[model samples]
Target: MTTASTARRPRGRSPLHGGRFGLLAVLPFIAFMLLFAVYPLTQVVRMALSHVEIQNGAFIWDFGTLANFARMFDDALAMSSAVTTAVFIAATVPLTLVLGTLLAVLVDRSALFGPIARNIALWPAVVAPVVVSLIWLLILSPTVGVLNRVLIDVGLPPQGWLGSEAGAMLSIILVDVWHWTPVVFLLVYTALKGIDDQLLEAARVDGATERQIFWRIVLPLLAPALAAAALIRLVMGVKAFDEMYLLTRGGPGDATTLVSLHIRNVFFDRLELGYGAAFSLAVVLFVIVVLLVSVVVRRTVRQGGAAA
Candidate 1:
């Protein structure tokens, strides 16, 4: 090749050249994350280790150690609140997955009222959780609540829905299911549309019944999407705060107090910034563990299915 042509042509692939544009692109994203997510998280951890005391009409900081963590375990109410939150997540995740998947499968097709059904499912998601909690609070009030009024009309006793410790957590779970089911419905419904029709046709041609086709062909194929929806709902449910905060305020003798609620009270309400940071870290650990377990389980299931 001519000297000019050789010069114009590129040399062998170089790592620096390959990553030059990509590095530039990722720099902005990294900067943004560092500024927003990472910085706040680091600050929380820092504050959790430091003490805040009033000095000369001003707040002063002092370094702390295991004292904050020790306090967390020692406080029975705090420990119970954490346990309650975990139970809330365990209860809600499965319920949301089952209901969301069923709704998605049922309303996925283009029927005369398909749009209407889909719209109704999506409505709850569009409404704010705080607003929904307020509305439910009014409807389920001990005496004058419309829900209790309806039950009374039907000859059943009027019950304290949010007011009672026994039923408060259940009420929160219901509200979560209502507001978030629509999200899963929309996601899974879209996933359903992407499933190949030829598989269904092939199953039918092989003399498989409709039920057989659904169980053997459709469900197996939809497992990944269902897994995705379940993970999304799991994370959201674990971190749920707004509905619980608005509806119950962790009331009725701490029956409905969730981990997030406890964290908020520690950091903001009680002004235990350092201890709150430790609590927040504990929560992060929980989230990480759940996610890792879920990924492993999904992989194991997929491997078993492949082997079978």
Candidate 2:
């Protein structure tokens, strides 16, 4: 090629990755991750594995071994709280997914009220969790609660909704579902909207039943959204302390104690910051593992989609 023509030609691909502006654009995000995400994670790790003590009116962290982990494991309340957290996740994730999906489908399929239904579905999510907890606490209170008042009107005894173990756990789960289901509904509903009406029409034109179209087509399309919403719910589920703490105070016994609640108790109440820090690191590890798995699953799904 002539020198003039060669000079006009580019030698590399577009500057999507290597341009100066590209680096500048990404610098803030990188800084944010380092400052907010990485730094906090490192701090948690350091605190967890250190011997933190008050010396000369100052908190001192001496780098040490994993004694805090051992201490956490040995604490009966800590182990129970971890198990309770798992149980809470196991209970809420499925309930939120099922209920959210059903609501999304009902609203999406509605010819007239779909928009209104979708908006209504998001109302619960807009309400703050703290506010929701307070509301539920009043509702579930044994005496003078509207629910109990109604029961008394019907001659049935007013039950202690948050007083007993079974009732406390069940009440927390229900409250969690009520508060978080709207989030799943919004996500799944958005996913449903991405689906083409032409596909559903084609299925119907081929004499496919409503059940067949939904099961074979709609649900499969919604799988990614469902998985995402479920993971997010599980993450939030581990933080289920706000509702349970407000409603039950983790009490009548340790009946409603969650891992976060236990962590708080150890840190603040028991003055065992080292053990709490270790358990907090454990929680961070769990969250990181879950997020990593989510990334892998999403990558696999994208590859499968591209292959198909």
Q: Evaluated with lDDT, which candidate comes out highest?
A: 2
Worst lDDT run of 10 residues, candidate 1, spans 13-22
CA lDDT for candidate 1 = 0.84
Clashing pairs in 1: 48-274
lDDT of 1 by residue, 200-300 (tens): 89889999998898788888787888888888887797688998999889988799998888888877788777788888887787789989999899899
Native-referenced Cα lDDT, model 2: 0.88
Error of 1 at 270 (Å): 1.7
What lDDT would each prediction earn against the true structure? 0.84, 0.88
TM-score per model over all chains: 0.88, 0.89
Misplaced by over 4 Å in model 1 are 1-19, 54-59, 300-308
Tens digit of per-residue lDDT, candidate 2, span 1-308: 69997788688755565679788998999999999999987888888888887778788878877999888767898889888889989999999999999999999889899988888889889897789988887888897677888899999999998888998889999999999999999999999999999999999999999999999999999998998898899889887777787888888699889998988887888776677789998887889898998899899979998999
